[model samples]
Target chain A: MEEVVIQADKLTKKFGDFTAVDAITFQVRKGEIFGFLGANGAGKTTAMRMLCGLSVPTSGEAKVAGFDIYKETESIKKNIGYMSQKFSLYEDLTVVENIRFFGGIYGLTNEQIKNKTQQLIERLGLTSVQKQLVVDLPLGWKQKLSFSIAIIHQPKIVFLDEPTGGVDPLTRRQFWELIYEAAHNGITVFVTTHYMDEAEYCDRLSIMVDGRIKALDTPKNLKAEFEVESMDEVFYKLARQATRAE
Target chain B: MKAVIAENISKQYNGKPAVEKVSFEVDEGEIFGLIGPDGAGKTSIFRILTTLLLPDGGSAQVHHWDVVKDWRAIRNAVGYMPGKFSLYQDLTVEENLHFFATVFNTSIQENYHLIEEIYVQLEPFKNRRAGKLSGGMKQKLALCCALIHKPKVLFLDEPTTGVDPVSRREFWEMLKKLKQQNISIVVSTPYMDEASMCDRIASIQSGSILSIDTPQYLVKNYGNQLFKVKANDRYRLLEVLKSVPSTKSYAFGEYAHISVEKGHQMEASEIRQHLHQNGLTGVEIGDAEVTIEDCFINLLH
Candidate 1:
């Protein structure tokens, strides 16, 4: 049986009177790629922040990697990896240096960092440019490197926020392969993306509309439920139900 | 007649090619899209025609005037919404709109007809500061300000980036209306699906134009026999499919888009047999409809 790696029950967050994230409930299983879908300003970020322990929820509960979101944020932070829309690599550092720096931040031992760095560099075919500063790399290379570093510590779950924005189709394709590999290794991937095609790649998807879970199902089932041929249409059907900020 | 024209327009920054020798033309009342991934030189092309940046070589013309010599005239006749939000954040929406209108020696009342549709959506938030508006509202206000002077041409650079799907739909609808008003529109975007909404498109890469045609034309000649293939183990299926002879495979959404070699017939059985021979089963293969994105990736190869 697959363990529930992440669970949320009536989770809510309100900024002043505006409910940025209303009561929401969902669960992510181990080794699942769970897609958290929403339009910009749809409270997707607010909900993700609450789960990642970056922000406190005004009400309800969530458990990430067996850690309570409110009382065990420090433990939660240690067991889950995170990557945002913005590339978080240090531009001034070389590829190898950047990896070491991130590994160090995750409290990895020098020996573990060295072994993992070599394997990662070889797997990504970055040996030729591993000594080059990250800024000198192409946008695609930088993006791939960022994802690898995010999971350097092999966290049980990884939260990726728009990880493939502004990249070419080939590069985006390659990045998802990395994600599939991670999920194969029993890591839960919780991701949010504006790109609907990326949403289609997930194992299961939950769409938030005006801070509410409007739809939740597998991509195929969601399309069937909405009677659409594509995830884009499914998203369009659900997102338009918003009563605010249309 | 061409509303805008470019002949080998190029620009370099610090000895690196930002926009290599490139050329395209937009016809009057036609919507032209410059489609590519980031750093594909779409912005540089737009800036040159909008008179924001000068070309290092070749030339461009807007409103039948040279870009370099008639920069001021080009600026006056062309409306540009940059890739990023460029409005005054501290000011209210009404103030920003008025400021833009007055900059062109006009008023909102003078050209109210030009942007009435878009402005009405933003009217309720007139008193709210521009920074306080949502992503969709901010873009709408920007479009309103850009259209305040009734420019003959419009250049929108990635205006839908970061916008939600619903707002993106609404924004494109607004653009379609503008095109009907006989205003030539040139938009640059990384969203390949959006390229289909344009009347014609130029697929660009590495500072060069790969293919330029109406979206339908590009898809019709996608350069190979394409098939949509899927299996139970999709990730493994992708790797195994790559090993098949006479094929170029790419991940398109949940399925693998395989472009079989020319004259290969690319029957579903042949592909299924190939995967089955590799101990792979439960394979699904069907002839795929090519999109502008497929054409763009084909050009990349």
Candidate 2:
């Protein structure tokens, strides 16, 4: 049996009179790629915030990386890596400088940071451009570098929020290759994306509708249960049930 | 007759070309799309056509009015919803609509028929501040304001970039309804799947036009025998695919799609045998559905 890195039981968050996340329950196993999916305004962001310890859940219980979300928020932050498409990496910093900066922040020693910087630059084929500013690189390269840097501390889990928006198909696939490599090295991947095709790439998916977990299963099983040929159809069928207009 | 025309339109930023010799035409009442990844010059072309930015080279015309000489006429005759949220965020939904209508020298009542379907949804939130609305609602309000004038041409840039699937579908349906009113819609999106929603699309890259055709024609003309390959071990499968002797093989969703070499009818048994030789078992091979995305990637290659 695989070790469960994340466990949530009846996790709920509320603001004023509105229940943004309504009694959600799920588990993420170690090294597994778990997809958290939902339409906009479906409380995905709120739920993710609660799990990331950025917000306290109004009710219920959850554990992230063996740390209590409420009592051990700082430990949870240390045990997990995070990267969002909207923000990651420093635009003005060179490739090596950014890596070294992140490594230093993650509490790595000089020798460790040096080794990590060299390994990362060589693996990403950034040796030629290591001295160049991050903003000078292409969008694909920037995203890949962001993702690699997020896991520079070798956290047990990484959370990605819409990591591959607006990238070319080839580069998008290459980005997934990096993801697969990370998972192979025993890191849990928790991601949220608007692309249904990307939902298929997950080991297990949970679709949220009206702040509830409407469906959770493997992609093949979800398709079979919904009688659909593709994840897009499965999503359309489920998302149409949303009562909220947005 | 074309509602919009361009010839060798080009633009640059600090000496770096953003759009290079790009040319395309939009027919009256046609829904045309500029499909490409980010930084492909779609917004630059849209800006040039909308007369918001001056092109450095070539020329363009909207409704027979020159983009450079008749900038005021082009601006007044076209409805453009920029890629960003351009509406007055502090204003209420109805106020924003009324403001745009007044600026265009028209009233909401005058073009109520044009945006009645979309406005009805926003009616409930008429008193809500535009900034407080959800992303989908904000997008709807923007569309309503763009169509409030009932212009002959409409320009939407990356309107569905970060939109959810459900909202994206609803947005396209709204565009289809607007098309019935004889609006020549020129929309741009980075999502290749959305290309099919347009009547015709130009797959663009690196500030150049790649191919222009109806979505159906582009997919039908893929001219490749694509097969979906899967196995128990995905990493091993990807490595083995590098030696599959196929024209192209890449990871797509849950499986790797391989387009076999031209004039070669590679049997499933033979491919499975090849994988098994590489110690990859439980391999599955099936026909792959060719989409506009496939065509666009092929064009890039």
Highest-scoring model, DockQ: 2
Give me the TM-scores of chain B across the candidates.
Answer: 0.94, 0.94
Q: Where is the poorest 10-residue window by lDDT in model 1 chain A?
A: A237-246
Model 2 captures what fraction of native contacts?
0.63
Off by over 4 Å in 2: B261-265
- The local lDDT score (0 to 100) that residue A245 gets in candidate 1 is 62
Candidate 1, residues B119-192, lDDT tens digits: the string is 88788889999998877899999999999999999999989887777788889998998888999999987678
Residue lDDT tens for model 1, A8-83: 9999999899898989999999999999999877898889889999999999999999999999999999999998
lDDT of 2: 0.89
Show how many residue pairs clash in every candidate, following the order shown. 0, 0
Tell me the interface RMSD of every candidate, in Å: 2.0, 1.7
True contacts kept of 1: 0.57
Error of 1 at B85 (Å): 2.2
Off-target runs (Cα >4 Å) in candidate 1 are B263-265
Docking class of 1: medium
